[model samples]
Target: MLEGHALGVHGEGVSIAPVDFSLARGGRLTLLGETGSGKSLIAQAIMGTLPSGLAASGELTIEGQAYAAAEGATRRALWGRRLALLPQEPWHALDPTMASGAQVAESHRYLRGLGRRRAREAARRDLVGLGLGLADAEGSLPGELSGGMAQRVAFAAASAGGAPLVIADEPTKGLDAPRRDAVVRLLAATPQRGGALLTITHDIEVARRLGGEVILLRRGRVVERGPAERLLSAPRSDYAKRLLEAEPSRWPAPPPPPATCGEPVVEARGLAKWRGGRALFRDLALSLRPGEIVGVVGPSGCGKSTLGDLLLGLTGTDAGEVKRAAGHRLAFQKLYQDPPAAFSPHWSLARLLDDLVRRHRLDRTAIAPLMTRLGLDRELLARRPGEISGGELQRFAILRVLLMEPRFLFADEPTSRLDPITQRDTLALLVELARERHCAVMLVSHDPALIERLCDRRLVLGQGEAVLAPESLDAQAV
Candidate 1:
């Protein structure tokens, strides 16, 4: 259904090397790579959505319709009818002002040619099929929904017309295990309906679940291509082998028990949070002790991030109290899940970082070494947040928070956008810094393996309450 020959994309003076591939009807192909490996660029090139000044080259054909670089009506006709895209960032893909259900209904109306009333009905059904409730899903706006919900809405919009080929860019990016499985099943079942699937992701596990062929890209070049099982088990390229080896794992030797934890630096008692008249959680209690890593984990939309916000005092609690040790209010720092949101769109990275450094009275010489350790280029400092990749932005966000040398740090899914190697490195750095500074770390994540490996203790939040799990219980939960 889709074919590309010598496909390449270029902006200014840089370009990804040309690549060739084909996906037959009902076929599945996964594109795997590290950040800036050109996987998304290739997908965008296929979808004919390359950013301005970045031109696509070579030939692309969708359903036997050929074009050098499809444009105008040729591209428009192919997009919604024959081909659909699940963007990497659902927030950007969705219309913020539109109701979630309305956006999906619009897709059904335009792509499937359904009447307004029928489209609304279909949209509700689609949302339900994706594990959302009809009443809640229909009433919520895109901004009101969580990351996982927004992704489902985007999926509903993309699949509404039953297009023959779908290109999904990190479809399971922010999802927890169960929701990730749902996406895997949704994409895997598409082939049975005569549609091909092309997935671009940093997750090898996702690729494994939707088994088919694997294409590994490195530095914008196709380094390896083969059956998913064979290549993953025994990759021919060293780079591919390293990528596979970076999957999270239990420590070979358990990390040295943390040094005697200090007194509680921040504590929350009888906390309650309500959104839109719905109680997200109540009577939640947790404490962070200096030099200890406390993990807050639960399924998506269970108020894990909300808990982070409450601790940071960014949001008001409906009821309850949050207490910080005397003189420590300014010592609280947060590493946000959505890195872009934490940064100013109008400011360059250099400006933002410099301002933070000034506020904290930090040594100016410390910046470069920190950036280098996080695998970020010194040159990136001059670029705006939007000008960098998500992985780069995530690293910058981590650096910004660490520079504060806070008494307590709240990290909300800090490495969610990173590749496996980068994730491991970033996590290690966070832990190392926490130990060195004797900082209390509150890590909020949906990643079981991560929580198991890094946290000294864990609080599992679900069904409107938080339960402190024993170490033995935590081991079995993963």
Candidate 2:
């Protein structure tokens, strides 16, 4: 059994209040809250890696081991064997300089005392068992792998430790429907494999799928705890009710119809990309009419985000011509999945947007309105990208693009980093702006619930080609 008794932690000028929760043998618990509610701090505290300047007073026990009583080396030794953690961002968890296989194999040596060859072989086998190809991926680095692939690799490594206590923090953040299901199913089976799981997430749907028990955290406090089904169907607490009500999946009405009588703002004929004898998105043709929102859904590494780059002229296409409507903005507005890496750290928010505005020669007077529409306050504009949350940067990126007033927009997993309330508001803002400007909106997302809310038509991609459905999206409500 894994348990946290009267856990309390704090840093210089920052306070982390005392919290209490527990997970029994083979039990599951989901920690839900808005960003910065101390979900991650709890995970780190259990893992014995609380950052410096942070003091902790807590009783964390795992099976027969007294985790709170152990010192530095003794605690470190227990990590991969007694307690394991799957962090939110796989890239941050992985060492980019090392090969994927080597990174995973290291855990085997540390936990099981296995030889190098045997450890790598074991890691390779686990990767294959997780539906990932071992031969091609084993030799690759995290930078070479896609977002979904990296997450899978990280999960594979974390699970390979075979720890009694497993902590997964938003394990399926950027994954698609099927991949997300696969990852969760894999983690759910961990209990039967003799591991207890503590999942930190804001997604109730994911929590329901990994059902065991639920613990709701709001503003650094435990507001509710019970069976997931009971809590989801009829929440007992007001905090839980507000959290569920704000979910975009619970929308009351369908989205408004796409604007009509508009020319195609962006068109691509036979778009293609080939590398290392692998062809991605061959003969991919797409036409985006002004004021229409086209949703792009596909598995990981299937070239959906790559298509976004081609649309923006960021990547070179092997064969095909892309044409835009006349007088269309030279630079397309885009919100990348990793917004922090997309910009320089030295530049403040204002400097970055101002430079882009000047470079694009966009309307200077629209700045205030643009920021206001994206729900950005004056204080945030003065902060650096490093100082803000992922959701804030994502919204700020959209605001920057809106300043250019591009005739066409491409957003790649824009809502993946945002919580439920912000996701709903952002979707609504995107819809309103597209209609008002008569811009073509190409939304690439893996969330079915999101596609149902914003898109007018669906474009599903598989086997390296996009398949367009003729049926209008008004009827695709769940």
Candidate 3:
């Protein structure tokens, strides 16, 4: 159903060298790559949504119809009906002002040619099936939903059109194992229905479950192309080998915790949060000490991120008192779940980092070495946040926080977008820096193995409850 000859992307901030490929009807092709490896670029090139500064070239054949890939307008007409691209950042595709159900309903109404009543019914069904409560899903906007919640809503809207050709970019990044499985099933359904499915993801597990063709990319070049099972189990490329090794399960368990943690940096008691008339969590009590690592795990739309917000004072708890130790006001920092939303599109990364350095009177000399350690290309500093891949921008966010030498850091799935190798390394650095700085860390992640490996304690929040697991992280702790 899809074929490309020398199809590639080129632009000011990013570039993907030309390559050739084809996808027959009922076929699935997954793209695996590091952040900024041009994975999303290929999907955008096919969708004809390349940014203004860039353009696509070569030839593309869709549904057996040939056209110049450069002629984006031709592909634009197919959007929402014949083809759909679920973006990496759900915010980019979601209408912030619109209610979640309304957005999905609109797709069904227009693209699927359903009446308002039927469309609304379908939207609610889709949302509920994805584990969202109907009232909560319909009443809330994109900004109010968690990253995983928003992603599921976005998927519903994109797929509501019943488009045969679907291109999903990092669809399962912030989702729990169960939800990830649900989404994988949905993507697999596209091909099972005799339509092609193209996905871009850093998740090796997603690739394994989908059981299809895999294309591993590096710096815009294809390094391996074959069956998913073969490539994942017996990858020929060294980079691919490292990717498999970087899985949280393969990582060695972290060293044992200290005999006694340092004094408390922040403490909260009787914390409670509610959204859209639904209780998220209540009577939650926790404390963070210098050099301590606490992991937060819960299902999508659970109170994991909300708890962070309450602790950071970004949002007030419905019922609670929080105490922050005497320290620099800026010593408490937060790394956002969606890096794009946390940054401004108007400014280059360099300007943003510089402003932070100036505002805090930070050590300017530390920036260069930190960038190198984080695998950030110096050239990326010249580009705006919107110009970089999600993983690269996320690392930049981490870099910004590390520079501040924060007393307490709330990291909301900070490495979700990064490739496995990068995720492993970046997190290791985060832990190392936090310990060196005597900083406390509160990390929220969907991967339990990751939490088990890195944290001294676990907070599992769901259905109006918060359970603090044991410090040793034993099975009973969960």
Clashing pairs in 2: none
Candidate 1 clashing pairs? none
- Write one digit per residue (lDDT tens) for candidate 2, span 1-478: 8877778667644355777777777888888776556677777777777655555667777686665621333567667787789977676678889999888898787777889999988988877866666654788898777677788888888877788788998888778878889888888887877678999887778888988888787656778888998997799998788888877677766646754666777899988886445676688788988888888888776777778888888788999989877775454767777676576767779888788778877787787887787777666666677555556677887777777777888888877766676678888898888889887888888876677666777777766666765335433311
Per-residue lDDT tens digits for candidate 1, residues 241-267, read 888877776334347557656578889
Cα-based lDDT for every prediction? 0.81, 0.76, 0.90
**Which of candidates 1 and 3 is the stronger one according to lDDT?**
3
Q: What is the TM-score of each candidate against the true structure?
A: 0.92, 0.85, 0.97
Show where candidate 1 strays beyond 4 Å: 12-14, 70-74, 250-253, 275-279, 328-330, 355-362, 470-472, 475-478
Candidate 3 segments exceeding 4 Å error: 259-261, 475-478
Predicted candidate 2: what Cα RMSD to the true structure? 3.9
As for lDDT, the candidate ahead, 1 or 2, is: 1
Superior candidate under lDDT, 2 versus 3: 3
Worst 10 residues of 2 by lDDT: 469-478
